[model samples]
Target: MTTTPPPTAGAIDCDIHPSVPSIEALLPYMADHWRDTIVQRGVHDLETIAYPKNAPLTARPDWRPAKGLPAADVATVQAQALDPFATSIAICNCLYGVQLLMSEDIAAAFANAVNQWMAAEFLDRDPRLRASIVIPTQNTEMAVAEIERWADDKRFVSVLMLVMDENPLGRRLYWPIYAAAARHGLPICVHAGSAYKHPVTSVGWPSYYTEDYAAQSPAFHNMVSSFICEGVFAKYPDLTVVLAESGFTWLPAHLWRLTKFWRGLRAEIPWVDRTPTEIARDHFRLTLQPVDAPPTAADFERLMEHMGSDEMLLFSTDYPHHQFDGNAVLPEGLSPALARKIMVDNPKNTYPRLQ
Candidate 1:
């Protein structure tokens, strides 16, 4: 393990998770009817629906508590995530299972409650802490409404959605959400997780957690292709999308493959005038946590060369998630200039509200 931390002082940490303790914590934020329904029906906790909270991979041992959620409150997050890494500002991307509920109305209620709870519990408590507004992608109107509600609050920097939603995110059905995000200058942050509406893999259901986890990279590829081929960038030119915990080592190769196919299929998708790589370069930014890179520093440098741009990677620790050991938040072989770009410049450029 690396004993020396990265030169991360005053860095903008892009993807730290603030776990909701339980469904009970959000009850106060929900509407009276929804709260009553939840109580009457004896609703179970949704905390572990996305990923098993107690799993070793879910949190580092030192970050986890003996009993309760990993990042249940702001003070603990400050101590474990912010102070150690010397993070100047961090965006709280809560990964509760609000997106997993089948009922659209229930999902909307929970999403609203989550956003409300985020504002009151996290954003309001710490000036340095910002958050992504959790929206229910199941219903477009409700999703837009949620964005509008939090759009004025500068602390809520982005709109959060699960990568594995019911439909490919770039389908016109979800464009309204993107439109709202663009209008408000908020980036759409897609995090790795599943709603379980379909099998995690395209072929069939996976039996193990590892398979399901590995399947997320492919899901990201599909969504990025969806966004590019579906003319999302053409429609909303100023919009930006952040892929949190979406491992980026595969990006250069994926873009090459996608851009190559688009040349042959450009007639089918008339709106996608530019190559997929160009579109991705302009519209997408990815978090640096969970870096899937080659082991050697020289190999990693070659991978970065293939990427074509350093601005696409925003710095992140993926706080409380066992992504890296100790304070070795960054990968090796990064020059001080490149490290600064990833940690500060890229984040400021991606998230307009942060500036």
Candidate 2:
């Protein structure tokens, strides 16, 4: 047998989802009343749910678990993602608070189960693994409580939020969660996923997954714009937000348009002390994967130039999802230093636990 080489300078995957099949496994550890609701929703098998044809492809073609390691086992995860460049993997759960429209109680319970399981199983088993604590945005109090409970766990590096929540992320209703995140020095990761109760985009439902995929950047732009204009970033300076799975190309144009609008409307929101672009540059980071346009390296470089900061771009392989392409999709011609920052340093800075 030939010997395989050890991993090179470690890379940290800033975005990935290691899905769990059933909420039942977690139920035994969850609060009593919440178990019934989790079982009813069939929270298990969430990964199998098909995206509407309009949704953008996000999974890898052969992305599934090895035959028998526990779903949360680190060894199983290594089998799926252990690459020479990847030293650590940060996962975001699939069936978290996106179900809030179903029932606040059910959403809150599911959030609790996912967090508890992640902390006790995955995080506990692997020092290199990290997770985002899912919280029910529909109920800020419970969300804050969950954040506070998991805040100190080094492995729980951030709070995961669905992009299409009822209230724009900037609303006061969501401040409690931000406050909790800030208090604990954790960032918030907003990912685009099934918007069960909320519409996927303002442009109306798309006819195919490709259309839906194309619309994700806009959805993210809108939410990020809301947070900036509403003074979310101004109020909580230390708080950082990651826009995951949405390609980076649209950011420059979105920031330009938002800044222009903010300039004209600045007087209306006296608390927003900076331009939308400035706030975005300083406080937000975005993961790069499933790039929607300019599939070529030259085009990607131009996109990054427009994005303004290399630090703001993080490497991600939306692993196991059909659209992921391991390392093949990372833009070509990136300098080793710049590539290292996107693959490792940037994430280390954003998710402090990795440090």
Candidate 3:
């Protein structure tokens, strides 16, 4: 299989995963009580099924470690993701199972520990590293508090929330989290994963991991529509929402369908004053990886034309994940100007802290 070359020098990678080596790694960051609780209960690592250990999609073969987890340390990320891509800044969107805890208190505790672990183990060790503040979406008050807790740390470029949560992202219950993110000049990075509160697909649970993984695009459609139809952009005009690891190829078609329905159902959502496509262009940005493009470069350019904006795609290696082969993080057929936007300009604009 052929691959395109790495992105331009000094690219800003918008999505890279830094796995927690183990629950033991986070013990230092957690309170004594929580640590004791974990030990006493014999709690296992928070790794989720979203990225199974042997799954090719979870880690590129060369990037995987012989023991323990891939991207488990700062050095590995520097060598594999940052250095190879010539990343000026790379945002770590750790996808541990902090959101899976049923107890809001435990979820919040783990979330805090994860952020602290990120700072000490990753960001503090690498000047080029930035992170998303992972929050427990199970509790809005706690989620906002987590955002506030890390807002002053400019290394945190965004707030991370799973795409599949207790409820659709657009509901008023989730607005406080959005408000906190906007107020702190942090973008909301809605990444592809599930809290497992519901089935990954609308048609109940899928039979295979591939089915669950493929379902992420449609899930993103639900999220984008929820944000628009629920008037999230109207209320948070300055907010930016980065859809990390969500493929961009499906967007133009999805927005076309949404805008068509909105034209007829305008009265149902009065606050959505503009077309869904326009709203998405203004407030939504998507990471560029797992480029699910058509067969040819010409086809990709045409797809870009349909997307209607050059400013919406941020470059991402997706780190240890097997989104692409070798150092060919970018897809072919991109104009130099468009490549520049994806690698640098668009990410800097979308992530306030990056600027």
Candidate 4:
């Protein structure tokens, strides 16, 4: 593999994983009531299914921190991700296992712990670092409360949610969450992961990790469709939706298919006045990590051209999660002009809170 170059100065990393060092680390941040409840309830850790701690894909060997999970501690992140990448601003997408909890109360407790932990441990430590406000989607009121709590923190860039959430994300039930995000000028970041309420596929649960991995693109496909059809863009015109660690190559075709059917079905969803592709191009921004394009540079170039717009792609290394080997984080053969946009311009544009 040709070595990808280091990032230029002033580049903003749209996605970086800062692992929860431990459940114990969050206790300091948790409300005493919740902390006591958690300990009394026998809960210890909040781990995400999207990244199994032991999986090779979770972290490249060299990027792994010396003593903890990849990117778990601030020092490891500084050495392995921020310093090496020369990041001017890096947004943390902490995908802790708050979603997996059976009780909304417990999930909200952990979510609070996670966000508080982020502020003190990561954002406060590094001026260049910003974070998404992780919320417990099992409860919308609680999720919006999370947004309200962190809205004033410029370092808290967006509200984080899983793509494979319980409902099709566009439903009315989820609108309040988007409303809050828009009110605060923060985008809703949808990462590739599941709440595991339903099988990732329409058919059912798959047998292996490969099946789960491949299923995520389809979840993104559905997310876009649900957002557009349910009038999310129409409802919150200024709201932006950031897709982290989601493949950009699939979007052009998915939007094309949606647009094709939308013209015929416009009357059914009267609120969806515009074409689906138009809504996507305007409202959605996807991360550049796990570009998932074909190996050939020519094919990758073709895919970019097919995407037909530069605004939708944002630079992301998906820190410590081995999307690519070493410094080869940027996709190969991208023109320098496009590279600049992907790295610096697009991210700044997508996240209004990023200064």
Task: List CA RMSD, all candidates.
Answer: 2.2, 3.2, 2.6, 2.5
Greater-lDDT candidate between 1 and 3: 3
Worst 10 residues of 2 by lDDT: 47-56
TM-score of each predicted structure versus truth: 0.97, 0.88, 0.98, 0.96
Q: Model 4, range 261-292, lDDT digits (tens) per residue? A: 99889888999988888889999999998889
Give a tens-digit lDDT track for model 3, residues 1-355.
Answer: 9555455578998999999999999999999999999999999999898999889899999999999999999989989988777788999999999998899999999999999999999999999999999999989999999999999999999999999998999999999999899899999999999999999998999999999899999999999999999999999999999999999999999999999999999999999998999999999999998789899989998999999999999999888889888777778889898999999999989988888
Return the top candidate by lDDT.
Answer: 3
Q: After superposing candidate 4 on the true structure, give the runs of residues whose Cα lies further than 4 Å from its correct spot.
A: 1-5
Ranking 1 against 4 by lDDT, winner: 1
Model 2 per-residue lDDT tens digits across residues 1-355: 9756432236777776765645456777667666665566555433322342122343344444344212345565666654444555655544433445467776677677777777776778766678888887778898899898887777788888877677677888899889989888889998876544555667567676666656667778888888987888778999999888877778899999988988898899888887888889888998867566576778867877888888898877666555545446466756678877888789888876667
Residue 264, candidate 3: Cα error in Å is 0.7
Q: How accurate locally, in lDDT, is each candidate?
A: 0.91, 0.71, 0.93, 0.88
**Residue 31 deviation, candidate 1, in Å?**
1.6
Order of quality (TM-score): 3, 1, 4, 2
